[model samples]
Target: MAATAAGAFRRTPIERSDQRVAWDRTDQAFFAAGACHILAWVCRESYSDKTIEIVAVRLPGQPQVFHTYAAWDGWAFDHSGWNPEPQLLAVNADFEGQPLERLKITEGLAEFCQKHHHRTPDQYWHDPRPRARDYIGRYIPPWA
Candidate 1:
């Protein structure tokens, strides 16, 4: 994930060609039956010195249908856990309902950070562990 200022993050919608874009956890539940878009982002929390990753799905033809998962441990989907903060979770739940042309990722991220700052950060960091290396290995050649 790219490094950035506090509360800054990157949003990427898994493309049709990306192998990983195929049906995954976000597609299992009834909430995502018509999901056509899967998006993810990575951000840093300066206040807690932690890194956070979020993955979300949008159901086509359903503007209000949104499901998201958050992970403070690492970038892998399995490591992600549901955000317990209702107010912040609501931001994600209602995100796709807004006008995409007018919605700014940065603005939405800032709002999320503002609402969830009160919670304690996750204690484990994956950056230094085997899971982190294994994930990177997916794209990096052994010789690299």
Candidate 2:
């Protein structure tokens, strides 16, 4: 599944872990990766507002902020506004719904998320890096 918005496109229905018994282990991995302090798998009753919410703290003692990303059309993710940091990028990346592969931790938290959750860089997410920078990062292919 894919979503097209403002001429931009993205994929969906990403599986971070197996749906069965692996769910618990996968959740732990995601937490250990430091991508988020609390990752909740929520089910919305309305299609008009169904989404996955990921709450995290950028650093210890920092205020906790709620980041909501859509998990429809076969993908999951949210935009980081304009700030581009590794931690924010990692949190958004996790919602991308794709497995973490070949993704490096330019930011400590993103790297932690990738390693602990076993995600690929090619996975979809609203990357804060510029187009050229995003490509150069090799976290995901620009053309992809």
Candidate 3:
């Protein structure tokens, strides 16, 4: 399931091409940059039956989300791959060295994005459904 979810978030050459400027400007890989939340939302849709949550990493007390991923049963999955939740949480340092906070959003993607970004996912990044379908096809996860 994790492997499939990771694959679903992998950007194809053209999707990469769609955001050519952001791709060229960043050091982060595919979904690691601005699109991490969309990646998490797609992954959550893949494992819909589980108690998976979309987790956002942000500076403490800040409404802005710096990163996002999917978490289920102590494991976290992003485009980068899987990590134990604790290890994933260990990397949240800002330029000033303030420890960022982890926000677990269970209310769905619209709620998550609206709360963190003051906009819906489509307003923030490309709508995720097409990319998810492109990779996962009609294959539902085992639990589903």
Candidate 4:
């Protein structure tokens, strides 16, 4: 299914997460790729599970941050936020509430980066740019 056609995935709010991210260099590369869809696609190709999803979210004013994780049983694994990296603003899983698709993610990312950042697919893919820091530096739990 198309990324746009897939509609919105249910937003899963993470109440608390550990302070440090124990990801290795390869894992960090995947998270970095979340900023650009082409890199995301490349990441998907390298991994064994093509079903893994990559999500990019942008707040009203902040630069977009990408979250690369797999959704299962209404939760995301290998997710980042409420920790070293920026807090995740939103997530799109696949259908049946899983908001992910390889083609759609890449296409949407390409369109968005080109229109907003004036970046071509190749430029965004090849360039070394800092990832988006945080959607909001502070976090207050829903129950709070």
**lDDT of each prediction vs. the true structure?**
0.28, 0.29, 0.59, 0.32
Ranking of models by TM-score: 3, 4, 1, 2
Clashes of each: 0, 13, 0, 6
Runs with alpha carbons beyond 4 Å of true place in candidate 1: 1-47, 71-144
Residue 99, model 1: lDDT of 27
Residue-level lDDT of model 2, residues 37-124, one tens digit each, is 2221211112225442332322233332323222333333323222223433454445643322222123333453444452333342
Record all residue pairs in model 4 with backbone atoms less than 3 Å apart, i.e. clashing.
92-99, 93-98, 93-99, 93-100, 94-98, 94-99
Kindly report which residue pairs in candidate 3 clash with one another. Answer: none
Estimate TM-scores for all models.
0.21, 0.18, 0.64, 0.30
Residue-level error in angstroms, candidate 4, position 90? 10
lDDT of 4 by residue, 1-144 (tens): 112211232122320121122122232333333333443433334343436454444333445433333322232223232221111222243222433222223445456566445244344333322232221112221222
Error of 2 at 31 (Å): 25
Worst 10 residues of 2 by lDDT: 3-12
User: Which regions of candidate 2 fall more than 4 Å away from where they truly are?
Assistant: 1-51, 66-75, 80-88, 91-144
Q: Look at candidate 1 and tell me the lDDT of residue 122.
A: 28
Q: What lDDT tens digits, residue by residue, belong to model 3 across residues 1-144?
A: 222222233455665556654444322244665567776777777666777788877778887777778887887776546666676666435232667778777776677666766334555245545554344343333333
Candidate 1 accuracy as lDDT: 0.28
- For residue 133, what is the lDDT in candidate 3? 39
